[model samples]
Target chain A: MEKFDKLTGIAAPLDLINVDTDMIIPKQFLKTIKRSGLGVNLFDEMRYDDDRNEIPDFVLNKPQYRDAQIIVAGDNFGCGSSREHAPWAIKDFGISCVIAPSFADIFYNNCFKNGILPIALPQEQINVLMKDAQKGSNARMEIDLEAQTITTSDGEVFTFDVDAFKKHCLMNGLDDIGLTMEKAASIDTFEAAAAQSRPWV
Target chain B: MSPKTLYDKIWDAHVAHEAEDGTCLLYIDRHLVHEVTSPQAFEGLRMAGRKVHAPDKTIAVPDHNVPTTLDRANAATMTEDSRIQVEALDKNAKDFGIHYYPVSDVRQGIVHIVGPEQGWTLPGMTVVCGDSHTATHGAFGSLAHGIGTSEVEHVLATQTLIQRKGKNMKVEITGKLAPGVTAKDITLSVIGKTGTAGGTGYVIEYCGEAIRDLSMEGRMTVCNMAIEGGARAGLIAPDEKTFAYVMGRPHAPKGAQWEAAMNWWKTLYSDDDAHWDKVVTIKGEDIAPVVTWGTSPEDVLPITANVPAADSFTGGKVDAAKRSLEYMGLTAGMPLSDIKIDTVFIGSCTNGRIEDLRAAAAILKGKKIKDGMRAMVVPGSGLVRAQAEEEGLADIFIEAGFEWRMAGCSMCLAMNPDQLAPGERCAATSNRNFEGRQGRGGRTHLMSPAMAAAAAVTGHLTDVRDLM
Candidate 1:
């Protein structure tokens, strides 16, 4: 888990709705057990042509947006498939925060576990950010996790909401497995009672 | 006190601990694992110096990366990438002491299908898997949903998941389904009305007379697409059909334990006064055989309708509709039935049961599919494949010029050797129609098995009723 207190970086705009996990990291790249080396294939089909050449019109392939650390996207981003590879690819590509009008449940939960911030703003707010993000390298936005605000390059500020526990974990780089281990006693108690009552399970 | 819904009862039963912030530590009763998602999770566990807390409670199967060809011994027919993934699952399962169903095992199948088949997904349990369709097990009155790889590792090492409660929703299907309509139509129709985001924060409990009338397999089909409807899970109350489906299976309880399990499962339904944050009512008679015309599952319409113009859509959907039409190479206002297809696929966690095979076979009996078009029927699992063969459904499909292939989610996501070529439009029975889901630049029109069979015979998207 990487700590995410604040970040000021270039923002890339993905102007599409219902951008699914299949588009983020296609099924072909899912063969590896390791999470690394997927950044090259993030949005593989959309970013490349049949000859394996980069499609220059894609925003990430543009000179200024290559190192974008934030993505301003459309409604219901990451809607299909419960692949953690979506966020793994997004993080591996150096993007830590995704601002969307809404997100699917599984993908939203996955982002927090991987130290990425998924902020859900109203459509009007997203519209504003989406417009600002088209400025390419000039679209620098400051994301402050503690203040819960995103400041655009032109000084427009927008506030967003996140679950408090998730915010706590992201800010501190907390390891969730270790935290769950701290409650081993409660889990042990539940297991003993459950095994005695419903032994078939 | 407020009456508890079916979801509330299951949630309460699984809470190992609750924080002051209302965060819950949920005890998972069954963890279904598959090759594609577990490799990374297993590697994470090994790197962290952790041991599986409850190996006996977890089950692993090789499905996603498996070749559907009959020569599956030692993964001989698979690509190098697919073979390594399947082999990784075998090694990880052995090293962690979890139950592994290799490709050669007769019981090996899609994780969701195999769980219920082996009676691992019994009623009144909490089920989690690394795949989105884990909601398929909710048909048995269990609280089931998908988890990310990180959560997979969490469940493996702790057998507990950190969680929060979801809102309760009821999708009550009223009246009787008209002839030619099936459970797949009901799910597709529901998604059309719900717009893919309607059930986002809720665990929908599907009920009413129509739902109660469905068999266990039908119930599973409807619940399998709960993810496509934007819900974490969907469930049906356990009935005699459910009990009959689970009794005497390898993992089901025996004798007195069975009786005890029955008593508890009987109580796993919503109370008469259960609270609901949202309720969607759809007439079963109104739901005709349906198909998705666009990349999103919500971009669907009844097969009797025509393609919709982008301008006819409201809100942000207008842009999405335009993009979808361009990607599909379809024109607005064209009759859906007039759109020809290059291929037909009939298998997925959504509609790969024996009943699905039977429905497709009934349509294809004594009739050959239109010439020069490719078609295949990949059963959900080996047992499903075997049962289809025993029932002569496989013979009918073969006689009708359709490929009778091995199981393991073939062409559903195109992870295996089976796939569509670029620009090849297909009439598929899989759940999602997302862009490049089947293959890069490929197009998919999602439909029921009977409808897919009709398309194969007609060389276009023909309504199933016409064939019947």
Candidate 2:
């Protein structure tokens, strides 16, 4: 897992509600076994036309937003599907932070697992960030995970809350499997008790 | 001691270790695996050189990316992408020593269908799958939910999941269902009232006369849409019907073990007066046969309603409704029954059980689908397909001009070859109505089996009761 800390990069505005996982990478692109190399197919249908030509009107396809590392999106972003590929594609596309009014629980957790910061702010705060993001490449937002704040290009700053343990893991690049393994003895005890109590399982 | 909700009891029973921060290492009793989301998780396992923690607890099948036709056995006939994904699952299962149902195996089908059918998903257990619809098994009184690939690999490696407690919600359905209304209608109506994201941060427990009256299959149908309602899982208290459905299954306990299991399962319901974060009551009589008219599952209306104007939605919803209307090709004020469809899909983890097949067949018996309409019934599993055939339901579908096909998650998703072409409109028995869910530019209207049959026979969205 990649460690997430303070990052300064261009932010893009995608003001659409219910931007589901299928819209992020679509089911067709989900066939890949490897997590790498999915950035090119991120938002495939929305970014491409019938002829596979780039649709310039789409936010990610726009000239200045092409290299966006942060996304200021609408409410309930990543609403459908438990596909981790959604966050995999987002990170692969160089976006490390997503600011939304709210998010579906699964997608929000998956984002943290993939080292993509999903910040749920009030819609008004999201509106502020969305406006700053529309300032093209010049609007580079600085997110300080340690400080728990996002600073816009114009010096406006907003604080966001994240779970303490999840925040610790993100800052340290701690792999969850490795962290869980440290408690293997406890797991073994639980399993033994479960086996004796419910032998059929 | 405080009374615990159904979700709280199941969640507490599975907690292996809890940190002061409220994060708990949840013990997972069952892990359902599939082709698409799992390949990367298995690869992660191989990359890390970690062995599976409990191979026997895991089960695998290929469904999403496989062709539902006879050519499934011939990999050459499938798209390269689809073939590779399915092939990868076969290898992963073998390498991990997991119980598997290969594509060529008659037992093979959608993972969720296979799990409950095998009794691998039981009451008082914690079930996790790589797919969102794993919530289907919660009908058995388990705490089941979907996990991402990272968590999939975590479960494979540790047999435990990291989870925090979610709020508890009670959706109480009162009154007996009206004639012709089904569990699918009840679920769709629930989502329609709650809207998408209404169940976020809550594990919803469904109870009441209407819910308890449903058969095991009907309960599964309602629980299957929990994800679409933005809840990670949904639960129904186990009863004699649930026990009867599980008894004598391939993986179910027998003899003394069965008695012990039942003793615990009988206590799976929420205690009377258990505290609830939220409580929603729905009168079953008010739930008419419904269908989704827009992209989101929440954009549903009773069969008799007209297309809602975008302006009818307020706040951030207005633009979403407008976009959905544009994408679905629906005109404001248009009667829902007047909408025409190019296809009728009767399958998916959501509505592909044998009971679902029988419901559709009842309507199509001694009748034919509309002229120029194409309809297909892809059962949830191979066993479901066989049972439908044995019951003469398949014959009814075939005689009615509906294609009776092999089982898999056929047209509910576009990954399979059974897909809608661009600009095609469909009346689907599947859960999702998201744009391009069946295929690119494909518009889906979610409904029950009988409702889908009605649309098929009438060449439009006719109320199933009208046909009756």
Candidate 3:
């Protein structure tokens, strides 16, 4: 629920397509009802070897990408299995924004819910950003959530489209429930009218 | 005047009020719950000291955390942590007087499957769940979708939800589907071509002759991928086939009520003059048994097609495809048939129905899984598992060197102990083949159940048509 104005972070290039829910947090981690602490084991199988040691070759383990808050990934990121935990883990891991050529349907919405900005850029635009991310951990990308634009270190600017309603939502941190509560006065009025008409209350 | 489409009919019927911000307050008819996302919602409810407004409208099941084995007593003890999670759901549901189908119950399975089979998902209803596959219930011509945990709690307390309006997308599949092609193939083809995000912000209505001919189960398969294709939901008109499928179920209407229900259901279709915000038509013949060659569902090609060359796509997609190929340990221009697999998985909500099992078993009859290929068959539901066994499919799978296991979301999400070792490549019937979808660093190739069976027998991605 943290308000987003401007976010600046290192780009972690996951680069994998269909990084599904199971791989995001794994079903084993779902055992804990708590959504917190999953960031540590995000992509556990790839993050750790059989001996539970960090797999140095994994993108997340590289010293440079370890602190990445922006993830520049390939197409159809977050595909397979509809588990919201995938977004929860990604958000918990400090990834505030995900730039991809595309993303799975459910995961894309779930990202908005968890306050993670998922940007769907064209393949060419994503390639430029991915290369900027791979330039090393320090290659910073700046996202102005208020302006709805993402700028790479090389000064390439991309304006992605978001639903006007969803844009209003991210700006005000209003989810479905939050939006409903915003109509408290009207809801109260309707309830009062119904109670008077039906005498049910 | 706009003619009524099924999407509009359902949406209008469920709209309680239009709020100032243009969002609608929808009356939820059914709310399905599972272990993974309900705990926090339950905790929130208790913190607020609220009781469920409509307990009968809600149902819970344990799926994601349950182990897929008949030795439930042993499987129950496998994960102490998930056991506590399931127990919490059970306790919360009991306290709220909400109906819950626990793991030990024969009726327990994925909530989406159990809801429709039990008639909880009837036409003219609005269903919501904490899981995205909630869209699967839209097969019954309902406005169904997934919500977050906070929204889950809100629905539990009020039996109403606030939802943004979605644009209507009519995806019409004209002409007949070729013999041997199924609804799964049609949906996979659409999703693969559109990319996973193609349907975002849209309510996809499956129309035209091909969709109309599909059975309820087949329709469910199509709707299940609505989420994958980025649609809020996918719906099919409730015709006689739909009415017949729901008529005698436990929760469906009976006697005179049934007649009234049919009248309403009949009117849920799009009128001949109805228009949609977007319309797309695909010839049924253009679809084939698809397989994911890269990390995304969109990274797919026909079973007979070669891995795409780098120059085949526009923009930088060629490089992206090339990178995916490298990570998947595949080479461009290689025949998909030549790629070997280490495992074959034939289950998930996508293709875990009885028909899918029959399709795979038909191919595996008298055929043995190739040496060094580990294969397993996990049914989507206990009922599916039982039916497969009664038909002796289990014995065939066992005899063919395949593991016939009990039903849960096993290996579908690589949760629990059912996961491929690192570096393993599997031909999977379930949706998605993202990097390590099966396990850490595990590679997955998405295919049909019959195709997975074919791969099991060949130790490579062989065309299922060859087996046919």
Global lDDT of each candidate: 0.92, 0.92, 0.80
What lDDT would candidate 2 get against the real structure?
Answer: 0.92
lDDT (Cα, tens digit) per residue for candidate 1, span B1-468 = 679999999999899999999989999999999999888889989899999999999999999988887776744688888888888998999999999888888878888899999989999899999999999999999999999999999999999999999999999999999999999999999999998888898998999888999999999999999999899899999999999999989999999999888888888889999889999999998989898899899988999899999999877789999999999999999989999999999998999999999999999999999999899998888999999999999999999999988878889899988888999999999999988899888999999999999999999999999989
**Chain A TM-score from candidate 2:** 0.98
True contacts kept of each: 0.78, 0.70, 0.37
Candidate 3 residue B133 Cα shift, in angstroms, is 2.3
Instruction: Tally clashing residue pairs in candidate 1.
Output: 0
**DockQ, candidate no. 1:** 0.85
Per-residue lDDT tens digits of candidate 2, residues B1-468? 799998989988888999999999999999999998899889888889999999999999998987787666777768888888988998999988999998788888888899998889888889999989999999999999999999999999999999999999999999799988999999999999998899999999999999999999999999999888899999999999999999999999999999999888898889898999999999988999999999999998999999999999988889999999999999999999999989999989989998999999999999989999989989888888888889999899999998877778878877878888888999999998887888899999999999999999989998999878
Instruction: Please write out the lDDT profile of model 2 over residues A32-84, one tens digit for every residue.
Output: 88888889989988899889999989999999999999999998899889999
Check candidate 3 and list the clashing pairs.
Answer: A17-B295, A18-B434, B199-B230, B200-B230
> Model 2: DockQ against the native?
0.82
Calculate DockQ per candidate and list them.
Answer: 0.85, 0.82, 0.31
- Candidates sorted by lDDT, descending order? 1, 2, 3
Name model 3 segments beyond 4 Å from true: A5-24, A43-81, A95-105, A115-201, B75-77
Report chain A TM-scores, every model. Answer: 0.97, 0.98, 0.87
Q: Which residue window of length 10 is worst by lDDT in model 1 chain A?
A: A30-39
Q: Candidate 1, which segments miss by more than 4 Å at Cα? A: none
